[model samples]
Target: MSRPSENGLSSETLFFTATWNGDSTRCVARLAPAVEAVPVFPAYDLRAQFEIMRLAREKAGIPAPRTLWFEPDPAPLGTPFFVMERADGQVPPDVMPYTFGGWLHDASPAEQRRLQDASVGILAALHQTAFTAEELAPLGEAGLRAHVAAQRAYYAWAHGRRPIPLLERAFAWLEEHWPDEPGPDVLSWGDARIGNMMFRDFTPVAVLDWEMAAVGPRELDLSWMIFLHRFFQDITTGAGLPGLPGFMRREDVCATYRELTGYEPRDLDFYELYAALRHGIIMARVWQRRIHFGEQPMPDDPDDLVLHRATIEELLAGYEPAS
Candidate 1:
């Protein structure tokens, strides 16, 4: 907490890694409650976020950052924050998008697959991990129901001030085709894309981001794994560049996960749409945040905020978009 660089004034600091001076032991700090400067509905709660990560580390045997300390009061920092020992390794870069070019691109196909398999393997481990009522108490008891409910809430919140019709249609589609019985409810690594993982030597050393972590069917995470990579791949493929083709194909990831956990991934068609819906809602908020910070102007199309607009529509129409 004594890091001078991080002590400077700021309305909100969502996440940053701090290195101790003595031994240079690095730890990540996650601050909560969107600053008034960049408002988003359903402000993140420090306690709930803390519990998720703590439970994942202690109970799930997942490679999560070590939950070091949590400060609820805003006195020490402008907002409530929690610190965890920073997991080592490089995250596939966001700007270049690993699919396009970066360290991942420089690596051989086999090494990239090693990282991809390890990433899915971590997801398998999470799905296979069980939890008692007490361990899951902090996240609420909605179980699988909680997944849809949260997205519905997010859609409503994002549209309250800024309506995106594409998001509306996607939400409606999800509601109509909602699975009656979505198999077994397990711990879903809610934000389950490879982007959330840290890899060293083409292997996931740490799994980051648990704010979206929830208890849901395996499909939620599995579908997200496919959809997110496909999004990036679509971009690169559109540019006529060879993207991360072998990274996270639907069959390959599902097969690897199945091999590890002995559970066949199902209902991915529905879940991928769900993933787009979820990502679309978050993207809308992100654009709203950009507008709030005066960093970017509002676009002509509300769907502009949603990155995979064309893909979402195609999926809704019962067709896989060309990726």
Candidate 2:
């Protein structure tokens, strides 16, 4: 898959899936200049992702993809990108929610339990592994305040594109109910859903997607794991399917995480709300992209873009979403 770069150097493109020993492998390259969408954050540091994966694999003993090389200059592939040895496994498709129909849905309840446990185990291992302050400095200071500040910047990034009343109200609720004291800082996988992980035979092969990687409380990742499953379940149930019930339940996830890490997860109610608010903002940006492409007309209700608008509204109202 090697091709000539602009400067006539050999550049390789790691296709999403390849084969080795007759088994599927993904030697992936995360290319930048991401599709012409509204920006999520101010910028993406490509080197940071490569560095984070390298450190997680070497020091934390985590199953992370091995980074090959990082080319900061975009000339090589017309955009800045880095290459890595993609670990083996299949990810539940995002476009078609996994619960809608997939190997996950057809898997026996027992087999699905194995997948859920393995994914939670990875998060526990990450939170338990200690890193020097110098190593995590790139993630910025550790605290809920720092975490919210970054999101605030993102909200500003999406300001005035289209009015999203839900996001505005969610932000206000967060400020009013800010945690009395921030939880202890640990390795927080910013986007910690199971979808971001690579699994083989229902066990995690490698933890992928570190774009939202940060230094914050363990709850940041923990809450996302719980909420994302609930998110998909919401959609599946609405469409009248069982949708992998009994998997990644809130009580089971909390108990498993506490059992594996020897630390109790706190303020999950708050964190789940945080996850919804953060996701709401990101969904707004996605809508902006739709508008840009003329794919969807301007939504009359900004909450229209948020798939879990009902769930989000429930959280803000201090009521748990229906099971």
- Candidate 2, residues 1-323, lDDT tens digits: the string is 54322110012344565666888655778766454544555577778778888888888777888888888998877879988885667887665789898888889988898999888898888888899998888777777888888888887877565567887888887777777866789878788888877788998887877878888988899899988888888889999998878888888999999889888888888889999888877766666667778998877777788868988988887743456
Could you give candidate 1's per-residue lDDT for residues 130-166 as a string of tens digits? 8887777666655556778877877777667768888
* TM-score, model 1 to reference: 0.89
Worst 10 residues of 1 by lDDT: 2-11
Steric clash pairs (candidate 1): none
Count of residue pairs whose backbone atoms collide, per candidate: 0, 0
Off by over 4 Å in 2: 1-26, 34-40, 319-323
lDDT of 2 at 244: 78
Alpha carbon lDDT of each predicted model:
0.77, 0.79
RMSD values for the candidates in order, in angstroms, are: 4.0, 5.6
Instruction: Work out the TM-score per prediction.
Output: 0.89, 0.89
Off by over 4 Å in 1: 1-24, 319-323
Task: Please give the lDDT score at residue 119 for candidate 2.
Answer: 88
